[model samples]
Target: MSRRTDNRHRVATICRRATGLTHDTCLRWAADGLITRQRPVPDAGTPQQRAFEARLFAELAAGAVLGLTGIRPARAEPALALHADRAREVLDALLPRLDGTGALRGVPGLRLVPDGGSWWLTDLVDRVARVRLLHPRPGWGPRPGPTARQDGGRDPLWRTHRHALHPAEAALLYGRAKEDGASWDRDLLFSRTLRRLRLIVDAGAQHGWVRLDTTGAYDLVIECCCASGALKLMHGLRQSALAQERDDEGPGYSGDIDVGGACVAVRHASCGSFPQPVAGPDLRWVTC
Candidate 1:
């Protein structure tokens, strides 16, 4: 379905607000191709299109942040794209946790590291565990019994953690031309600018997270809403099939998985999906 959204916020204004950059600076970045010209959405556009714009905003702000940090236009644009691509990968697992108005209700903070780094995105939250309930149907009367498969077990039913990616502990690499042993400029302008951008991102202004009012106008909520809808549809089909199983019926069933916003359907060749289910390894304990 299509909805009408406010289109009056200028791109430069958003950039300025996100990174504290002057309007002129943002315009220069746009002119120099640091900020690619994202397609404009009409007042009434599909939810998906609006969601796309919200995603674009992240790249735009990231580019401006990179540029202001003294990275040249050529390097900044592609770097921003890489960051956005990685962020998009986990959105399907993310969207269900958001509240109706797109505000983050009870999500935890995330820790994200820049690309080409050791920890690009942090591991899943440790406190909680996920399990899938499975029932086996026999030929006689009711199914054999039900079994529980925890996450990482062949396949487990999944639910999202309502966590915000803010207050994120992040580390970004700043490539320097100076020799490894030599002292580099610690107080470079770009270094200062990068720190400022980090603050905005942490506070949820740059990426529009956590806070209620601004979040409705920015990335996480809108993008999450659209993407979450698709994910719900995919899970719904598989869940419905599982809910209707009777003991007299066969052992297998068709299941769907959400991958990059699209549904991929799979079926088992033998009795059913995971007939002889193999349990995954146990979680290893680690101290931070």
Candidate 2:
């Protein structure tokens, strides 16, 4: 066996050699509470911590050599589940609040369900969830449709006023988008909706109609508009107070507002939209 030059060579050197990541990166990870390091007590230390450090080093080194950092991105599995559970709870608390005269009062007649699939109803649920996350109360409205004419003609009425679109109108818009080849991928769709939701919250807060609270939920106050002909749309939103915090604590918001009117219908027309609101038998009418 070769002679060991020093104890440092055995531990720190081995760690650096095994991980392929820079010594600083390893140390940073350790400092950030991501990885733990062990030091022998003059002669002995915890074997578990030592093993973990060695394994992490080795994995990093291997990743470097293969140009494949085996480290998976951090995820919030437990937090996500918790958020989903909380979403269900919040939904339960919200439906009753929708009963009286207001934007939500029209939901019963629209056959709203808990499922995130119906266009108008899902929009409503999403708006509520968003408000709950941003302020104490939640609200959302239809996104404006394309101003330019498409090859088929002006976009459908539903596309222009999804919030106001009837079932028949939604069906027509869905067919049109499918025909035009404008639908996006799941990841893209989620990202777009998230951005749009933020903008809506900001606009409402600025107008003094809503307030985005510390928990990311909103406090909403609906005002009656005399414009009876204006189309109304609802949004279905999901917020996770337990998951992550907003990046900044500024009074302003950033990001694009182009949440594609074309793709919104795909979410609006599905079955998941309505059933997501009511719990049991109360769901019958909404589902129908």
> What's the distance in Å from true for residue 129, model 1?
34
lDDT of 1 by residue, 109-184 (tens): 2223233322222223432211111112222111112322222221111222224222221111122223263121
Give all candidates' CA lDDT scores. Answer: 0.26, 0.24
Worst 10 residues of 2 by lDDT: 73-82
Q: Tell me each candidate's RMSD, in Å, in order.
A: 24.5, 23.7
Model 2 residue 29 lDDT score: 44
Candidate 2: tens digits of C-alpha lDDT, residues 1-288: 233223333333323332233456544444454432242101102232222222222222211111111111111100011121233332222221222221221111122232232111223212321111211123322234543223234433223344555454355436644774333332233322222232222222211122111112211111111111001112111111100122222222221112222112211122222223333333223221
After TM-score superposition, what is the CA distance of residue 14 in candidate 2 from its true location, in Å?
A: 37
Every model's TM-score: 0.19, 0.19
Which residue segments of model 1 deviate by more than 4 Å? 1-14, 19-25, 29-47, 51-150, 153-288
| lDDT, candidate 2, at 37 | 26
